[model samples]
Target chain A: MTGSILEIRDLRVAFTGAAKPVRAVDGVDLALVPGEVVALLGESGSGKSVTLRSILRLHPENKTRIEGSIVAAGIDVMALSGAALADFRGKTVSMIFQEPMLALDPVYTLGAQITEAIRKHESGVSADAARKRALGLFERVRIPSPERRLDSYPHELSGGMRQRAMIALALACNPKVLLADEPTTALDATVQVQILLLLRELQRELDLAMIFVTHDIGVGVEVADRIAVMYAGRIVEIGAVRDVIRAPRHPYTIGLLSTRAQGGRLSGKRLPTITGSPPDLASLPPGCAFAPRCSSATSACLEAAPAAVELGHGHAVRCIHTAAVA
Target chain B: MIFYASKRILFTLPIMLGVTIVCFALVHLAPGDPLVSVLPPDASQVIKEQMMALYGFDRPYHEQFLRWLWRALQGDIGTSIRTGRPVSTEISKAVGNTLMLAALATAIGFLLGTLFGFVAGYFRDTWVDKAASALSVFGVSVPHYWLGMVLVIIFAATLGWLPPTGAGPGGSEDWKWNWVHVQYLILPAVTMSVIPMGIIARTVRALVAEILSQEFVVGLRAKGLSELGVFGHVVKNAAPTALAVMGIQLGYLLGGSILIETVFAWPGTGLLLNDAIFQRDLPLLQGTILVLAMFFVVLNLVVDVMQTILDPRIQRA
Candidate 1:
């Protein structure tokens, strides 16, 4: 983490608005070097999206309490307030959301949103100059009839085109790091591959570090360099993509990988599923959260939450029975 | 845009036809002689027959409808039984006064409602939102006629700072924009304003809250927009529905002012309608109803076009 572009230490995000404050993210530690693409893979309520959003401090200011330190591009992200926070966002890092249509302003044309983002970050740029840059981005993202598509509202475009427009919008200011929060989840399966490929190409072309959050292992393999599997607000396993997927050390990761059909062909037998559901984040146990559903769970695993233990070559696992999973 | 507006206008024609039919039906449905107030009390049945024939009431229903519709189209709405003036003239004057009052009141209501709505919505679930919500609820729940009377008691009767009735200085029929006439308007206009203020504030509050909850708001903030810039987007997104509410409120105020105008004795169509209902002046009643209904139709058309212009999601084919 010495030369990392962004580093997070012991991040804990809790939503105080609820009757009982929900700890959405607890004790998360991550670092991203420039040009690295890491995928946070988890199912719903696994804190994958929450961790990504917290990197941008996107939670409501009054209703949420974030306890931790985050430093990005030599700037203390957690210490920023008002104007400083505004300056840090989009100029240093930007995000692409899951739903392109919902993420875009319905009233504004795509061109206007892009130009606005550019002008907001770069003060001296005129609207015309900003729009020119937006047009260039539209072309860079391979949107057909880029000039005409820029003027169209999000609802006017096809699913793939809207996702491209959104990607173009995200890249308008050319930030160092990009956050893709299930960017292709709301798209058609056919269009999903196209957007994924486009994002991968642009992430490389721009030399931008990206943290992609998705549940699909196929997508993680397609775009991620490293994979971090989260279980109930903690990264249970993290390593290079091939290492984690092929040699998963955690029981939860093993169960997750087992649930998917191996070679895209149905065996006709039931696809194996983990026995129990994920733990409620509001009231998690002191021990490992996945122990209730873990097939190899031991009585010792119920005593305490296991810490992340490093293996060789940047691979790590957090489980009392890592050897049992292997 | 022009095509949309024109198409919306064309759609109102059937609604217009429906209004006329209802107005014509009112004559037949009511249980009284049409010429009772005009003819001599002790006259023979021949006089009644002659009067009925003279006014074309003796014609077939369809013939009578066509004639009434024709005259209404030509702006010859007949003479008022209560005033002896042409129904059109009385309506035109009352409409002028009502239009002026409606404009002032709606402007006040819209500005205050929008301010309160944005504040409450932006700082939702806070004390400011609570206070605004309470005020709007009060506005909506309180009977405006009662409020108008209370306002008159405080500002006009007890304080003697303003007039309690009449449309202008000198007790004249003409309305001027001068302070003397304007003071007469304040109590009633404020009274009329509360209805829209309450309804619009509620409508806009919900609109703003929903818009803010949408992911685009996060997207806007994520793109480095200042809170002010985000507010601008919320306002634009909320505007189409908010203004549509305002337009519909204005239309309601036109006819719904009967109780308010009676409380103030202001010479608007509400007061005209009140007098027409009492005196059984069918012609005046029919004309006012037609005009008010037409105002509603046109207002809806205008609101539809405005919404289309503001929200691209609602594009009309």
Candidate 2:
């Protein structure tokens, strides 16, 4: 009962296609305790979003092959079927997306969509009760003029407001686990900070376990308590947010930090980036997926996949030469 | 909203007027002498001249058009040259038949097409989807007359289950809403519906598939909406596109009914149009064509308004 609110064990997601299966997520494991926010930080092809989606089994069923055990709020997520699976969603685990305009149905008023989600998971809830709950969620998310905003369609709201509405909808059921896939990536910078602060405040108030997926290290630092840096479908390093930022053990994580530093304050300096592009998942290199890009790659690093070496205080890194590199 | 509607109506007026002028000119310029058709082949030159003058065919083209336009404005489309009856009366009767046929066909086509499309899109790349797609493609390619003949051969000629032609049996015009009339309508209606149904199915499948792949769909599913709920959202999101396509298909059905009515001997405007063309009955052809063109324009307007209502994005535009 005191374990992590969300536990994902050895998750592997491969998409079946015409030629060969693309391994979007490969042997990734993560867990989130109640009231904790873990940011899955990675570049575009790093499989951060795919890992988040796999938690809810949201990929197209026939095309996706998911092999893992996902337990959310003490429920066996991988074993749920039909109505049970749907019931587990939103109430037990809810998700918000990057683009609010694309996430909210254009034809429906915000109020209707939220209330319907409330009523859907709770069978006996009356329409009026659901609407009241929806109103409260809107206010909790700090959407201005919630009553009038409820009647407005998705397109009527600005980008930031729409994202807030999306958050309100995701929070309608008071889920224990919230999976946000780049939720603030599409908003303006100022709006992004406001939303991030709002999300942190809500997460604390509700004591919800959240997995925030993002590519920006800056945003990750602002919100996450712990950070899991993924590279080429695997977690390269994971630790407390400060620990990962202060002294990254994995080379890829180090490269990401360097780029962030280059983008801020040191404007005129040549931006140091990872040497090469991420390896194609369909034809990944043997040993470490990051070997070609790693500046510290060795013969041993290229021969076999490195084991995840545990550091003290729950810190871990999957690299053969962590000591030498550090 | 009222202003938008009024603007749309105003736009249609010029288009309808243009259609009437074109229809009148085409019928007049056709290589046929109304007087020769009306009078005897050996009739005296005086008799032929009198007939032409009486019908105003001897007048200048602009004068004839002006006279027709004036009469049309006063709610008189002139008398049919073939029947010698008021064109308005003939058109009214034909309108009823055509409307009944078109409504039935559109309803059947839209429902079936939408259902098939939903299945195909929801279970994309599966056997059900592939089969539905193939069936729609076949439906689209088949000619209406050919399909009507096949249906007649199967249902009427071989099976002897239904009548092959006509709105109803003789002396049953007053009872056109009876089961006998419905029995006679099925063949032609099915034939008329095939192409539209196919078109709708294809369009709906493509649109629904696209919508289902959108990020919002994933967001909805992640919220734990059941598969059925997600499908419901998909359909609602895809409706405006489907409806827009249906409106266009209905216009096509109205025009295609001409050939279908002839093949089945249905007493619709299509049949009337066929007869008018053969007889070179300029007034009847002009009246029917003008009315048909007006129906299409109005149908399109209704569709635009309905789309705007369904999707507020279009309303703002």
Q: Top model by DockQ, which number?
A: 1
Model 1 per-residue lDDT tens digits across residues B1-317:
88777777888899999999998897679999877877778989998898788778899989989988998899898878767899999998888888878888898899989888888887789999999999999989998888998988999889999889887765647567789789888888899999899988898889999999999999999989998999999999999999999999899987759999889888888998998888788888888898889999888888898899999888643
lDDT accuracy of residue B175 in candidate 2: 43
Instruction: Estimate, for each residue in A1-326, the C-alpha lDDT of model 2 and write its tens digit.
Output: 25889888889999996489999998998988899999999989889999988888888787898998888888988898789888888889999999999888888889989998999988899989998888898888888999899999999999999999999999988899999999999999999999999999999999998999999899999999999999989999999999999989998898889876644678778777778798999887779999888888878888888889988787899998988888
Cα RMSD for candidates in order: 1.3, 1.9
* Cα-based lDDT at residue A194, candidate 1: 92
Can you write out model 2's per-residue Cα lDDT over B210-296, one digit (the tens) per residue? 998888888788888998898888888898999999999888777647778889887778888888888877788888887888789
Which parts of model 1 are misplaced by more than 4 Å?
A264-266
Alpha carbon lDDT of residue A200, candidate 2? 94
The pairs that clash in candidate 1 are none
Per-model DockQ: 0.87, 0.78
Lowest summed-lDDT stretch of 10 residues in model 1 chain A?
Answer: A262-271
lDDT of 1 by residue, A124-186 (tens): 999899989999999999999999998899999998899899888888888999999999999
Runs in model 2 lying further than 4 Å from the true structure: A261-265, B42-49
DockQ, candidate 1, comes to 0.87
